[model samples]
Target: MTNTDPDIRRKAEEIIFGMWDTLTEDERKEISEHLTIEEFQKNEYIYKELEIPKCIKWLISGKVKICKSGVTGRDQILRTIVPSEIFSFRAYFANDDYLTSALSFGHSVVASVPMTIIDKLLHTNIQVCRKLIKQLAIELGKADSRTVSLTQKHIRGRLAESLITLKNSYGLEEDGYTLSIYLSREELANMSNMTTSNAIRTLSSFATDKIIAIDGRKIKLINEEELKRISENG
Candidate 1:
């Protein structure tokens, strides 16, 4: 991995550690000294499944996908990581290797601080400990909800939920209806826990019903309310 420019590293630290203002000067300095920043190309793997956990990572820019290989070698996308979000700490905390792999969705910049430093902060700062615990709890809740949605929801409902999730995570383009992020049909299927063909068919059905419009990979929501209703009813 190539080292990031100092200016970029400083910017990432400001955004990521802005929430940890409670840390003392020495603690902050220690973190800065140990943090490493690297840039990843589009579709690159930041880390792979079964890799030993080394650091807590922050997505300084671009998007990341957290996924695991399914029984048939298909990938099941668990979540998308947005800019400034912290990740890759769960495995370290659990004393296990990474269960899922992290891949860059586009050209991305990531910053990593050693887990040992995080352990120190957790020991020395009560607030830091509480914040990390709260983050873990929130992630756990989302995982549980997704598990139920994938297992119980029909194909239409699952696809609707995935579209809603993307909109919520990345927002819409300037047109205000088209999704900002363009994902391939295979990626959509992985996220919804369905086959790519099923996702494409369901998306077409939505367009035919006037619930959405498809322009190549760009999906424009025509009836956001109806989509939400389907997701909720499922």
Candidate 2:
């Protein structure tokens, strides 16, 4: 199901506006007027590679993954976004089409604020500008860290790290062990930088080791400590 409540929209806008502390009441209202909310189903593309981005999208709820296709049509998951995070800003700043595509991991809601509005706000609000700079720096750091982790870590380490990353990004279900988001094996493989068959094999190994329990798309962490140890040691 999709979210269409006016109250939710207002709350999402308010959260964004709060980040731009330098904006006046009129300015906030002006920016909010240009914002639009969109919903995407599981595996739906928010934007595709080479598409010219005209808006900055803020994930309001659910999860999305940004990915790029390799030379052989294999996907490499670059990053995952959770609620209240802004994306598609790189395209706006670069004045180019998107380098990667964003897809909803599940039913998701996002707010799209026009690039023109963002540009205007940046020019008029020093606090907003500072916040954007800080966010960019943090993103760069994360990219660097992920690059090192993906290359240096072993397959088991990579898989364990991927599981922890997913848990952090989406949280736990009501049972407190099952992952909140369910991804297909291919998606999991892409996220872990492995082939689908390899991912399946590794998952089976993890299950046999009693590190995790899998029931179709549902993954429950049975031994979080051991998982962390493997990820750290490798």
Candidate 3:
């Protein structure tokens, strides 16, 4: 939904207070001055590859996908951003243009804090810098794990891992079964490092085996243990 500037700033304040407890009042106030909220439509580009990284982006609501295009013109999804998650600042730290692109996986609300302000804070607030370092490390570890899985796992295993990843990110709907996020097979294939045809066939196979129940784009995880075993074995 839409809200007034004051409302948005209040939300921004709440988010900062919860996440950045180490920041002093003065620092928080200054950072708030540079904060801006943006609304994005599904599939809208948040940042394109090679663009100068100017700000740190936080997803306040909905989902986002970080992706890079390959030599064959296929896009590979690198990561998914959930609510309250911070992303897109690593490129700024590396002092380079964005290496990948970010787009809205669905309609989303995002908050941006300019890197200039962040740099000033980083110089003054040791705690903030440490927090950022830890965050980067966690992301690096996940990336490493994903690399191994995609390179080593068979198509079924990769798709299983992708489903588990989605479940972890969004959880289940009120029915306590269906995946909360709805994605097309092409998007699922991109995230799982497979072709659309493979994704479709594997999904059908999973359904036939009673491992999952599919309702168009909605996939309900019916047998998570079997899925995990497949992922582990592959």
Give candidates' CA RMSD values in order.
Answer: 1.0, 1.6, 1.4
In candidate 2, the residue pairs with backbone N, CA or C atoms under 3 Å apart (3 or more residues apart, or in different chains) clash, namely: none
lDDT of each: 0.91, 0.89, 0.91
- Model 3: how large is the Cα RMSD against the reference? 1.4
Q: Across residues 1-234, which tens digit of lDDT does each residue of candidate 2 receive?
A: 345689878878877877666789988888778878888988899999999889888998889999999898998998999999988888778788899999998888998888888898888888888888898889899999888878999989988999999988888999999998888999889988888999999999999999999999999999999999988876
**lDDT (10s digit) by residue, model 3, range 1-234:** 333477766786688667889999999889887888888889999999999999998888889999999889999998899988889999999989999999998888888889999999999999999989999999999999999999999999999999999999989999888999999999999999999999999999999999999999999999999998888887
- Least well predicted 10-residue stretch by lDDT in candidate 1: 15-24
TM-score ranking, best first? 1, 3, 2
TM-scores, one per candidate:
0.97, 0.95, 0.97
Better TM-score candidate (1, 2): 1
Range of the 10 consecutive residues with the lowest summed lDDT in candidate 3: 1-10
Task: Enumerate clash totals for all models, in the order shown.
Answer: 0, 0, 0
